[model samples]
Target: MVRRGVLGYVLVLVGGLVVSVLPASSAVASLPLVADLRSSTGGRMLGLAVVVVGLGLASSAWLRLVRAAGDLGVREDDRTALVHRATAAWTLPLLLAPPLFSRDGWSYAAQGVLTHLGLSPYVWTPSILDGQVVEAVDPMWLATATPYGPLPLVWGSAAAGLTTDPWLLVVAHRLLALVGLALLAWAVPRLSRWSRVDPARASALVLASPLVLAHGVGGVHNDLLMAGLAAVALVVAARHGWLVGALVVGLGVAVKLPAGVAGVGVVLVTLPAAARVSARATRATQVGAVSLLTVVCIGAVSHLGVGWVHALGVPGEVQTPLSVSTQLGRLAHLLTGADLVDAFRTAGSVLLVVVAVTVGLRSRSGDRRTALRATAAVALALVVLSPVVHHWYVLWCLPFLAAVELPARGWQALLHASWLGGLVAPLDSSLRGADAVIAVGVAVVAATALVQAVGHRRAEIRAEVRAGAQARTGDASPTSPISR
Candidate 1:
């Protein structure tokens, strides 16, 4: 128990809970303890204190849970799966409440609902008529008012059209996101099964992860639709079929261009595995079927034309700490007069390209052995290294990490904490003051993940060494590295 990471997780969570439970209303005495960002002279300090404590608690709880996952180990499949389940499960309550500072979720819902009404959402600002209730979309989104993409608009419209109330629209969108999650839970395992991976563990990692709960359910970002589609596409491709694979992957790209990272992995799988003409043809057949499926479904749903293309006109979000806007802010502060916002957008775009190339190179071997891992790294790296990274963006990486075979306790602990920090960045004023927290936290978790992956390589090498020695000596009494 002492060696396991659970003890740390439990302690931190309890400490955070204690802090959170404090009566923050008595700011006359507690003002001194308020975070710097919340250190405003006004009575807002009391509310700020509460938000800070809550964010801290959430961050601690998330990290501890990740550590718990590491403690469970690979061989303990059921137990390990349970850990991911525990983390994934919390998403239920958090999402039921208000949109937890996830402005993106709100905008997505707003756009979808508007589209469903046959209104040009991008052109019709949520700021129109009522207050800026749909605050997530571009200020110019309504002005640009062009149709973005067919799929997202259809989804957004349906979700939004469910109710006239902004709040209700958010709820319906989350429900739709939940449906996407069901597809993910079903699809990832099936993909693993067909690919001969650790089907139980792989499925567990994805289906039960804390990150998924936080973002998919908590943030309720529409990226889940993209990820779920991507996973199904992989399953199709890995089964040695390509047409359906292309269509699904294409749909993923339609939802979010970054979702296209999976296509790189698919391309890798297609090359050697389909090296033979017959295999290549079979793969082509699958791709064609998938293409047809996507085309027909999207066509039936909406008019796939200029209106849909216009939906993507709103390129970057500038309000939150997580986007290219953040970098732009810093650079503008440095460079005499150039806009940091412009800098950030440029930097983020370049980053996406780099991550794509890197993922492509790593996955070129065309084996499922590293396919998911490489794809995830590519996806995550794109977000992490970008000028702006959002909490929901983490959803893009969780599935790959879930399916990864190795788990390092220390690194997992870091990821757990960082995931929580992502949640905190929006609500806590302290985070704004101590903005450094997010940057440091993200670096820590990313480093942790890298360490865990590398550590596995070292462990494997040692195991091989021990096995070779045993073979030489023909010893039966010594222990095996993996048997425990």
Candidate 2:
């Protein structure tokens, strides 16, 4: 197991090193050697090849780590410790590497600088800033105001104060993401125990997932922080009470609004198992009040007002294929030659609210496990039905889902999703304008790796099923000579 982890770590590190050389829109211009390499087509192709191979290797390694985590002979505490150590080791390579998979880190740095200059990120675009910071920002977001809450702005402002270098500032943001990762490490196991799932298995699923590593950590996304805090909130609420949970989730909301959904779980878990409708409503109201109060206090303290609430629609401006509503809208437009994107998006939003309310109402009288599942369901609904869906958005519910027991097929689906999500950015980044031969080769390799991984998991599942059936038959057989 240790050897497998070491191998995985080495593969990811090698891939990360190659990725570090690829010219990102937000990359710092200080590395002359890397710059020279990136300026040449051959160098770029070599880097792409290395990156593709690295991703395949890393994906395989992650699969092995997850599989090893499920060994029943391993004690739960030992499994948890193994996952934690492996996660820490795996994170080391990407810790200092340039932001992987996305340019949002650049935006965070620029926004932080804006905040430090007493400019409101909620109102001011990163374009307002001058120098390397603004240069590193993606053009699409250059003029777009950030819809993120004030807490992140404040966090960014603190990092900006420490370093004027854009790369360093982005690294600072990565450190913030690390804090979130720490919270997940601490919270996932407790939540898993509450749900009667294996702590190590759940920890491996969330903390060591390729999706979390590539996007949550490598991308330096604030979603990591939000998800971590939300997970902690659910666990805290389940153990301590709803008030503490409300406060924790409120802090999460201040990082990203979607995290506010966890507040429902907090409320539901605190209600009596046979609570009346009025009682449920009252508890929800109380939790909502505390959460709202927390957000209001954060905004006031940060001096960045709650204007972000109005700008929540900012992300919807971009269309992503992952968004069910966006694709449906596009399909409608294609068929009817009419623009119905907004209508579809509005309908999706309405449906999400209805689902959240229905789930909350039905789960309010259930156990903590049910509340946790309900929260996960609402989060999944939010991502699926939102106007814009980024791959990392799934992180919002990943911890909760990991804490719950899932069937073999469900785990298989998650594994596939994680593998694909981890590959999306590297493939997209490396293949654009690349030599056709190289692109095709890389795609074939990735597809083959995925197929093999899936096939291996299916085989393992079949073996486990057969073993279970044999064990059941053995238990049912008589030990008497007559029966023999």
Candidate 3:
């Protein structure tokens, strides 16, 4: 455990260092202090190589420590929890350091400010800001607002009403993330208990995860808020044996449209039963009741009750490489000399829905918790594979992955590493003129290393499962315990 803690901290410390030095974003008020630093360096290139290398090394070390400690006995569980918490402590500062941490967040704030001014957000775009009172408009918005769900717009606009300072919005967004963090503190232990996973083990895994800490806590991504609601819904559905799982999912939708990814699973879980017949019936009933609740709630919050649908159409302009449509856009630019990232994203999202539905219905081959986890994994994979994968999308799977009885340790490691790397991905984009290099070298390279961690865990879990099965069958002598 001591070794694991030392190794993990060393790595995380390195990663944090890398994160800290990366260039600030466009939103930061350019202070002469940085110019002084640049002048000291003779305006030469900053320690780009060192920053990237440090984060890389730290990320790898942290990944290894998580795997090594996960393999320990009862003591390993306690150690894992401790190390995870320590790692999570890095979240706040890391987020505070980045310039691009709140690109979309600012858009939400803009909409909020606009709404407070008696203007319908559905009709407002970032382009309208030239004559409007506002914080620094996120140049990243190009000419439009978001393509995200409307609930966030409403809430963000409300928050925006509270301040005209871009810096203040950043602070507000972070504070909002604390609510999601509190929810995690409350739910993770319970979710772990439901899975029969050690509460401490579960807490360490979910509570301390780099993804949950960075994306959910630091970046103030709305995904966390909706994720908390979805988790709450999951727990409530199981506890009450209610057939309104759809409503829980709907609340998530109230936050963001992407949440419907998990909502679909909730519907399956809440199908109603005929005379307490099969689990399907009860789950179905839950779906119906939840769906009704979702519609009513959305209507109450939206401009025209259906205006969000229209606002969704407005975000069709921003071309982003983080999304899958990046590839298609490149192809279009090559062939027709046209930029189509947003259009491609829309089409890609459509196909993703199809794939998600197919997987949810087909993977219908596991236990209750298993089914839920599998559904979440599919959703996450789809999000990752989708064009323009904002880092926070990872928040969708962090909790579910932690709660599930996964088949291998490699899987767990993959989730962790990918999560950590994701938090750092946008840091590159914040760097002027160096984004391409940083994104590819540090961010992408780190992600690949994290994938290896996943492989290690997957291989490890398979061996453990097989050994247990053999022992249960009385087919082998129990001469030794497995070690990784």
Candidate 4:
């Protein structure tokens, strides 16, 4: 057991080191070393291969660590602590690594520079800036307005106050992301217990997840901060009262609009199990009022106003396969030979609203478990039906889902998806032409092997459960030594 833990830690650490050497999308072109590597076809190909391999190693290590935490011999508290320790140790290598899967970290820094210049990010694009900071932003987004909430801009502005160097700015963004990871570590166990799920398993599922490591930490996405705040809000609401939860979730919403879904959850969980429909309605109203007021206050203090709400459509400008709506639109266009992408996307938005409303209404019975599950469902719906989707968007629903008890197959699917999400980072990066093809091929092979391994593990788990049951039955027999 000790050996396996050590091996997993070492594997992930080494993987992080290998991946960190590759040039990031936002790497300064003037850097002699980076320019030399980028100019070489052979170097690019080799770097791509190394990144794929590194991601695989890290993902495999994460799987091993998660499984080890599930050892029946370990106490729940010990298991939770072990996962936490593993997460902290594994994060060390990537803590200062270049942005692994996405260039959003650089964009964040650029936005902060904009904020510091007294320009509203929602009103101005990074293109307005001059110097290294603007150069670090993705060209595609250079002229596009930011879709993120005002609170994130404020956070970025704070980081900008420290330095204007793009690299240091990215590192600062990463450090801020760590604050969110810490919040998740603190909240997941409590939420798991509330939902009657195993705290250790939940911790491993959310904290040690490759998705969290590769994107939440490595990519420096604001989704991590939003998720942590939402989780803490739910826990606080359940403990203190719905009012506090509203305040906390409002902060989350100020980070990202999708987090407002948790506000509904806070209201549901705070209601009495046998509360009347009228009571549910009244509770929802109060929570909604408090949450709205909090968000307004945050916007006012940030001085960015609410222009971000209008700019939420910014992400839809770029179409990616990750979006279910986009796929559906493509399928429709192919079938009818008509440009139905926009129409289909609009329908998806409407459908999302319907599904969220249905889930929220059904959880009015006030069962905390059901309320939590409902919140997860709403978050899932938001991602699936949105006009645009990013790999890290899964963070929105992950914490809530991790807290809920799932079937064996459900857990297996979620685990595999999380690992695969991290492993697919290369494809999401700036790799083009041959490098992209190689990434796709490697991802396919890795995904297949992962599925097979999980299937085998599932069989072993079933066998163990059967054996344990039989042993207990034998011990209960009249002629057995213990029975005698």
lDDT of 3 by residue, 1-484 (tens): 3343334334433333333332234332244544343333322123333333434444454444454345434464566566555555545444453323345555555666666666666556666764223334456563554555556656656667777665555556666666666666566666666556545545555555555554565455787787776666666666664444566667677766665565555544544322233444454455656655775567566652545665564433444556666677678878987877557776787877677656555544324564566556766666666665666676776666666655546454645555464436435333545544454555454665567557656855775776678778987433112222
Q: Against the true structure, whose lDDT is highest?
A: 2
TM-score for each candidate, following the candidate numbering: 0.65, 0.90, 0.70, 0.88
**Tens-digit per-residue lDDT, 1-484, candidate 2:** 4445445545545544444433244453335665655666666556555555655556666666676677655577887888888888778777766667667888888899989988888888887677777775767788988888888889889988888887788788898899999999999888888777778877887887778888888888999999999999988887889899999988998899999889789888888797787888888888888988999999898888898888888878778888898899999999999999999999999999999888887774648888888888898898889889888998988888888777767766776787667755565432335566356546755675667577656857664665567568884222211011
Instruction: Give the winner by lDDT: 1 or 4.
Output: 4
Give the poorly placed runs of model 2, Cα more than 4 Å off: 1-33, 364-366, 428-445, 458-484
Which candidate, 2 or 4, has the higher lDDT?
2
> Where does candidate 1 have its weakest 10-residue lDDT segment?
14-23
lDDT of 4 by residue, 96-131 (tens): 666666678878888998998889998899988887
lDDT of 3: 0.55
Q: Model 1 reaches what TM-score against the true structure?
A: 0.65
Q: Report the Cα RMSD per candidate.
A: 8.4, 4.7, 6.5, 4.6
Q: What ordering of candidates by lDDT runs from best to worst?
A: 2, 4, 3, 1
Local distance difference test values of all predictions, in order: 0.53, 0.77, 0.55, 0.75
- Clashing residue pairs in candidate 2, if any? none
